[model samples]
Target chain A: MAVRNRLTGERTHVPSAVGRRSRVASGPHDRHHEIIDAALELFATIGYSGTTMAQIGDRLGMRGPSLYKHIASKQELLVEIVTGMMDELLRRQRAALAEGGDVRQRLSSIVAVHVQYHAEHRYEAFVGHREIDSLEEPHRSHILDLRREYESRFRELVQEGRGLDLFRTSSDRWSSYAILDMGIGVSAWYNPSGSVTPDELAATYAELALRMLGAERGD
Target chain B: MAVRNRLTGERTHVPSAVGRRSRVASGPHDRHHEIIDAALELFATIGYSGTTMAQIGDRLGMRGPSLYKHIASKQELLVEIVTGMMDELLRRQRAALAEGGDVRQRLSSIVAVHVQYHAEHRYEAFVGHREIDSLEEPHRSHILDLRREYESRFRELVQEGRGLDLFRTSSDRWSSYAILDMGIGVSAWYNPSGSVTPDELAATYAELALRMLGAERGD
Candidate 1:
């Protein structure tokens, strides 16, 4: 099965039984990426607790024991996929915020980036949001901290826009949640084959976000 | 432990080890509700596939075999909980829409009801969204039909508002998704002890929804 790498938007092939027989030499780094992608695909399809390491090996056409060479355990795979996703989201959000337009432009950019990321990384978004409880201990707290920081970026924009009088909102906090939640929701229902493209969906959501904030100008 | 009944939102007491000794007489109907509530609480805390009838019985201080008297299987419990939620949502949505109001008022009432239902029934909302995959066959499709019907109520309002020149939206479909998703998200993050009451949160979200639709007037 071919699974898309969560970190990079690239397809990584996990060989089927027939394809495994014709495999050529692949580097450990490539193997590591393939294993993570395979695990991500399974984790999203099946619940984390319901997925087994052996099933992941089966999907990749590797022996269960041989799979340990690339990854330690199932929980570690979840940690990697989720944290990697959050890290990427935070990176993009920072870049978007730094590419300053006025507050309206920045808010729109942020919402657009958010919607696009959730749409593009649907599997990561699914597992990240659904499997947060399964992520153990310090890793869970760390991921949550990252999420809070990411959410604050939206809230900060709303506050900034409010201060500048460019936006009028009933409550900056709830407005930010409404905006962010709606964008996060893209992951649940976005269909790549659907008429709306990710970029177009992102643009529409951005317009909705601006409208939600009562922005002075129309997009 | 006391579990809140999903259907009625009443707190049903499931006796602890000590409390089980002092239990008063309860009818089978009451026992059935208590069992369902316990199962709902457990399913929300632990994923559906992870929970067992043994744990449900344990939580309610009944022998595992005794549970068969109340419910047939774990899947039945899920079917009941999910379908019950969808049914109730459909009922409330119809009531909200049937109340005579302009398009704006009707839309606001529907959003308010949705946000408040999700906030009050957080456990049901959590399980309904996350455990849809766990629900079997015809039941799943049936619940989904109810959901589509419920969503159309909002979309119809948006379309009506547009026809009346009260709402100017980029796309009626995406706008409805944005409005509904934002309200559904209250289930994930709403804190009962927070400064904002559910009614207050509902009002704020309704305002945001109107703003998102580019409604002509403010609340």
Candidate 2:
């Protein structure tokens, strides 16, 4: 799986001006990023219910109610974090689809994007997988809708392969589920400090995924 | 996938009557089962740390200290629940292996056993997957050993398929991971009340698993 430039987004590092404003204006965007980072770490370690605003505030070197100044409630915080993660995933998927490639290449690109996203943003992936039900009605539905769209990309690719007589699987839906499950499982055990880079892991997983769907390698 | 007895052990559900001297032990075995049942539900819902002995006691209509009289510690409770679940899995895996079938049949049987075990024992499976790491040292290692042994059964089947020329996949390890991940993922979202029975889901998953390994039917 080739790493496409489109898959790369702007680095999240704060600029000098933004850093100065973070100390002065108490910017919503800066506070939003802080809340997300803190929530991600807490959610990963203690899970959703086990984490609280007090604990999140402790991590941010602020008091409990100070967190409310930035975010409304714990459920709201959860929705924001989950929605942010899903939105990023949607962004990556769109970028992968937009890049110039054949069906096989595009599918591989999608797998790579998924693997890389999960590996680099494991906290978000964990929250996404585990805490979806914590969101309220509209937010929950919106996130689930985005997730369905993300999954449809893989299903469409599988159908394309079937159209080319490359895949003879019984059900495309389950095939897509299997592939997505494998990709998501990467977050549970993948260690960046290990031998394989995220790109290499993505490549390995993409190859396996293609083989699972009976896609032949195009020389 | 035939439900054959393979473990070569006593299939008898011997109710342990040794520890019923306490007031909490009207029927030691029944009470023990009840404790495990409640623990599984609480662990799956609120997670390990979020669950307390007090909550467990309240759920069972007993006090906190009473629970200690039955199980030594919360850690012990976790170990007992996980061990019971793993033991059942081992039994199913042995049965699948002992059915004396071809590579494809054996592989399907293994997948079926895995999915069926999780589907039938959803609470146990959920606790085993999510709260396993919360177990302390020796107990943790014990469960890990059993899990490795269980995984080896499937790995051996994959190797057997490779030796029999039934698999077209390049990497046996990846193939095994894919099948195992698919089975474990089933536990995360499977609803017994849904349209598909555990047996049907197992059959579907097994078919997909075999296809992923490039195992042709009847091969």
Interface RMSD, every prediction, one decimal place: 1.2, 2.5
Clashes of 2: 0
Q: What is the iRMSD of the candidate numbered 2?
A: 2.5
The 10-residue segment of model 2 chain A with minimum total lDDT is: A13-22
Error of 1 at B103 (Å): 1.8
Q: Candidate 2 residues A163-185, lDDT tens each?
A: 88877666677778778877887
Provide the lDDT at B56 for model 1. Answer: 91
Best by TM-score: 1
Counted clashes in each candidate structure: 0, 0
- Per-residue lDDT over B14-128 for candidate 2, one digit per residue giving the tens place of the 0 to 100 score: 4345544655645644666778778778888777777888889888777777887777788778888898998999988998889988888988999999988877787888789
How big is the positional error of residue A15 in model 2, measured in Å on the Cα after superposition? 22
For all candidates in order, the CA lDDT equals 0.87, 0.80
| Model 2 reproduced share of reference interface contacts | 0.40
Residue A7 of model 2, lDDT score: 48
